[model samples]
Target: MAVTKPFDTILIANRGEIACRVIRSARALGFFTVTVYSEADAGAPHTLQADRAICIGPAEAKQSYLSIEAILNAARATGAQSRGLAVHPGYGFLSENEAFAQACADAGLVFIGPPASAIAAMGNKAAAKRRMIEAKVPCVPGYQGPSTDSGQSDAVLLHEAEKIGLPVMVKAAAGGGGRGMRLVRQHAELLPAIQSARSEAENAFGSPELILEKAVVDGRHVEIQVFADTHGNVIHLSERDCSVQRRHQKVIEEAPSPAVNADLRAKMGAAAVAAARAIGYVGAGTVEFLLDGNGHDFYFLEMNTRLQVEHPVTELITGLDLVALQIRVAAGDRLPLSQDDVQLSGHAIEVRLYAEAPHKGFLPQSGDLVLWRPPTGEGLRVDHGLHESGQVISPFYDPMIAKIIAHGATREEARRRLVVALERCVALGIETNRGFLVDLLRHDDFAAGRATTRFIPQHFETPAAPVADDTLLNIAALLWFERAAAACGHDPAASWSSTGRLGSPVLLQYGETKTKRLVAPSGGNRYRVQDQEIAILRRDGCRLRLQVDGQGRDIVFAFASDTLHLALGVRDFACRDITYQPPAEAEGAAERELRAPMNGKIVAVLAAEGERVSKGQRLVIMEAMKMQHEMVARVDAVVEKLPVKVGDQVATRQLLAALNPAAE
Candidate 1:
């Protein structure tokens, strides 16, 4: 067999799912892949899948995955003399870093992306907007120039926001991913948004520079997938509608947008191609646009200089492997297809499955994935980086666990298939947005293809905590009775004595209510759950089969660390096992302690010891999973003790600070 390209070995400078994704394509193309990981990810799934794995730095991204020097060194150390080497910056870390790209070229290695000059030209949001406007692409009317000086007053930004109108957007000039981006709906909110945006931008991209744009209200976020080669050939692979979003970040993405007709597609596609040509792009890139839902009007949002997270949807619709295209282009080969050769087939939709609690403001969750069983069937695809059961979802990176994609002959079919797929995708240990995704799919507006950037926030309401239904209570009682019997050194299967008497009673607590259930012997493998009779059909460890009122039901249930965990349908419920003695409460000031809600690094401390703070005042800022969360004061009190400092990594429920009553 002959090698088709120059590079026979590729180093993946990333971690998790994207790293494994790149490794799969690289290996299939006859390239031995090398993976770089942080110390914490030494035993991760991605590392084990690669031909060679290297440790770059510590757990923090700055010292590890994002370190240009560390990645380059690893690539050099893993290079084979007989084969050429290349580096693929999957998507997040250094994928868009121009310095890293240039360093690859300087070290005589092929960077599997666009030229450094192109990344430099488009990496900055402000500069990219200018280039797009110069290319005659319709752009949103706002400030695209320097909005602030380093560490200086943001008055200039506030003034520009006022000029752009009340509702303005502040975004990081250097990066994307919704970090350092905010939407201000009023004049009074402009300054706070700017300050917070600056802090986040600095932490994410190592720069505080920003750009402002008029927030597009009720706009459909449609993006065109464009590819260019060194031979001056550029073409668009059609579009994906990423309008269904929360926190200005896309949640669901699909190809062949319902609102994009042939004419509109042609127009948007042309603009995307032009944008790619303007930058002399040589690889896969995405040109994002904000389409006015009321009409055919569209404006250029920005261009992502690398392959997007939602590229799977585009691949399903077009029947193309985008990573393979990138590899070929990086090898100086011309694109295999021209504009006319490109075609769109069936509809495809992709939903990002994040390890976060939707009911808890979608805050990033970190814990072990006890049970991960993603759905699989016709036209159903799941791209994930998790290894197996007990794989921990860490706080050092993005919280997206997997991408669930479905393809069908029509948009409605794809939507329906995606809904069913989500229902069957059972992920148990930590919280996830699985049920919330199903809810969004079933919403009338989403089903009717009326979802926009504001759809989740405007149309969908955060579901309240669910109450345990009758079935759930019955299952809980059965498990509780079994646990009690085990504790008493009695055989759970033996429900009666030789004289044939009924079994003992069992007490269990569900939330705040404690109920006593009596299990009586009813022939073989049948027990009573309170007043209802449940026949045990089968039992497989935590998973069980029971006949309730003559109807059969299957469920997965477990008890871990004294917590009762159960998964029913698309929802997961965990209740504290209060069967033990109740613990004593903290006293005085300790009772008024503030604790970390999630595992994160402290980024800011807004309150000082001895400082009198009002209720609801911002007290601390923590960065977790690439987003900043503010912990505020719950009551008007004097800050008595501050335990943690900036840049300290704290675990979930770790005490952060304490407060005492303030003098009247």
Candidate 2:
């Protein structure tokens, strides 16, 4: 519906990135906007963006963003129009809460999305799957019927090792975004996983009920975006390839899967349409599916009954304002457009830039962001909630920093632009997944469109493997020394640059103690370090950039390691410190070696030297934060030794198992 005007005023009951986006859109539409925030978010972007901003409650989500009473009160206090909310629930808190939707209805206002019934229906995974089945939509095999967190009620779960066979996954009835789920491959591990999953489900969502579905081997996760209006009209916009993921969460998404032909797209699109019509669904929602690699069969996973994070790509393809469409539908306006009215034109891709590290084990990072520079220019759309000096990177909420999306005439162009866009995108003062995203886009399989949900952890390796290149550290050190020497007023051309001025002590800080190094510029764009001369290049900063021949040409830098990484571009390079710590030359003995998998702790050790173990048997349990993960043997072997134990600290490459196939 192309309206010549916007709504009078919009009440927003959400927080963070999506909320800020809604306010921007509403303002552009000539509407007044009211924003609500918690006490902790008094200075947040969304709060600052509103014509009228109100503080709802304290910092804790239960009393603040998630409190229905407080949100409604904020709405009433600031709103004077029809009392409707542009209501961008924004991915978390009250977005999917059905009771909140019903409350919005009882208070005489418009809910900008699906009805309360649809929210309640789609809220429950098992119920949603059953509804899809009734709607004639395809579904995954296994028991997804009326199952709750009854814990051990289904013979299908325990026998899952026998039924769908090994490596079956158990999911919560209300699980979304990867919580309340477990992967069990053995009988001994089933009950504990179920208990832990149930406990988490009950704690996080107040419902321990769960559903079980057969794990699709090498499943390519793809979802279709569909928009429906109150006029009983529905349309499928396009599809997003969300196969690059970790822990069941998507990191990268691309529109129009390279593997999906027009014929396959039609089948998936029809299924998505059937799903929306089944619930009499209205507004915009995404229907997720697990597509087989063979491009033959696909099944309905779940329908996200709200605007998705990756909606920008769909907008790029069809050139529709899904948010505006949602507002129009909520305002009692007819859809105006039918199924044929919607069209998919071009290719688009979205990357979720998070404040985490990829090579550092995708560890969640929290700190003040000294800098925030989003990539811009042609085909780039940035949706973010941070500023040059914002301070909301706490452990309280999701670590998503921004969403960078690019659109182009074709999928190849989109991918190419995506790579370049990330290179220019920058976020400092916190660990970020920018490097990981760049690595993924350049990965062999991803470039050729060989994607599945397992692509990330499978290809990148969790607890990132240590890199074999030592030249990067040497380069970084050289840059550090170069900057220090330059700042101390030393001619870089002199071999005795740091020998001290006229017999005084020359103190320079490297780590803690003041150290001096003999420095000399050897020829053009080159440096002589001790006995070796290395090539140095001019990076984007005042710091001396060095390129060593012994080291590889991969790690890129723009700033120093300090309170803030003052860089101008995205940290889009996979960096791993895989240096070999060999034994002393005289000892003639060595430790088997160890490496961390991701940034985590060693929770338990289940093996010892000469301990015979079968393939796929548990060898070690590494714990990160509050979750525990077990390391299993890839092949039948004897444990030659164990270097780690319970409560031991470890990084991704830390050794926990040593297999001797000959001993086995």
Candidate 3:
């Protein structure tokens, strides 16, 4: 292998963590880096990190990251047409778009990924399955017909689904990441599932094509990291088990699957390598499979012709810089290592930290990050795009804020390290699934390697809201009191008795519950709140050392106006101080209001203003963070006021519709 630099400058046509990740490796390899950002990401970390930054368009992905024309113009303006420039679409947006790849070639710019042909071959789930079948790759029994074509109707799908038996999977053919996917366990669900999946597919991937597969119940999701070069060398870096999933999206991924033995690894790796070779894949790609509970039987799920989100786990286990390899292969250099030279040294686990509330059906959350801290320690790696506190998490993109990875000598060690890292990680001011990730890693089924694709649905369905501990609330109340006292020019350390009276009672609201607590100073920085005694041992900005009921605890918190954001143990809470504000308004007036759950664009309005809807019927559908959420009628009602129509951008809690109850 020889050092070769095909392009002097590389433009990362992506944003956020993946863009930053690529910049790091490309800069280390001595290539000048350029990053493209949308209007929403003008001052983002990736834009700042790159040697040159270009603004493509607005906050919406279609006008910016996903717009190949905008991307090409940015490249050309940056001298891509004159000087040597390569574009790296990092794992999302237009990463797998064959048209984008071909456009780069047509413009005399190199695309730092697989060939356009390879992307097209694997971009469609139906087409890819057909090619894999031709290549002798084992596949799940299903119908791969073009469901969105004019001649092929829903009746054909229903017929084929019946032949495949009950419990089939309706999936979008044009994309992955669990979008446009539905599991149908009943006969009545098949048609609706097909329609919903098609609509989502058109929105997400610009295609309405779908495929049906026999649902491989209780199966493990295993994917092998495959790399190739122009010299025709291809090798696999082993498999990652992404069995811990929710809503068909991977939550936790680990390298060297516990269910795969040496022989099984060899078989899967061979299949993955064969799949890559069949498409003449260049650069990095992943071949995913659904491994049955028995572990020996496996079927091709799909091929992702881009760097995976869980590639860091593979990198940790193999001591390889995959991005660097991708750049090298795109530069026309042969692989530096052969299949025999590949090695896996340690076990690594990765978890995606999403800005979502798991208890609320994993609904994506958006707000200001008043405080953001990534844990640091040995064997821990935090990859994120957030620069600091006060960064607004816009709903224009994915809700995944960061990825935490840990590597250790063994699987147990890796699991423990990852759990500890997650516990120490702090992301405040917005609801997140952080605690959920910790609990999932510590679950007995996951620890004992018994988890499958059905693990979450089986054991953790209907996740409960985290119970607010009294002690934690007491600490929040005390902190609120001290801050208010300090703001009024009173000595926070002084006894409340010095003022000859107990201060105003603090009214804290968490979720929909409100509690009023009277705080009376008891000397020595101690405060009696309700019946609980809490003492502030030390306060350093947002960090606090406190003693509650003889138990010493350390907590991190932030105050944004009337709100107190704090992290206790692995959970984060945001409490609003409504003491001075007038309240007591009845909530019944707005009982029939259907509010938008988050900031998003209304993609579908299923009901008209005067239409009558039944309970549980979907009335409106909004697209946010690349996923669609349905707003259902809570009761059988007449849609009194449907203010929002399709294509309207809405804010969180913005009223989309109002209903009047129907006569019983």
Top candidate, metric lDDT: 3
Q: Which stretches of candidate 1 lie over 4 Å from their true place?
A: 1-5, 147-163, 191-204, 483-490, 496-523, 540-542, 580-664
Model 2: residues with Cα > 4 Å off, grouped in runs: 1-7, 81-86, 147-156, 159-167, 186-189, 390-392, 463-664
- Per-candidate alpha-carbon RMSD to the true structure: 5.0, 9.8, 4.7
What tens digits encode model 3's per-residue C-alpha lDDT throughout 552-601? 98899999765788988897887877777666332332447888766778
Ranking by lDDT: 3, 1, 2
Minimal lDDT window, size 10, model 2: 585-594
Candidate 1's residue-wise lDDT over 463-551, tens digit each?
Answer: 56656776776677677767767889977767755576475565555444655556665657777666788888998876788888898
Q: Candidate 3: which pairs clash?
A: none
Q: Which stretches of candidate 3 lie over 4 Å from their true place?
A: 1-5, 146-151, 498-504, 583-664
Task: Name the lDDT of candidate 1.
Answer: 0.83
State every prediction's TM-score relative to the real structure.
Answer: 0.86, 0.76, 0.89
What's the candidate order when arranged by decreasing TM-score? 3, 1, 2
Name the top TM-score candidate: 3
Q: How does residue 468 of candidate 3 score in lDDT?
A: 87
Give the clash total for candidate 2: 20
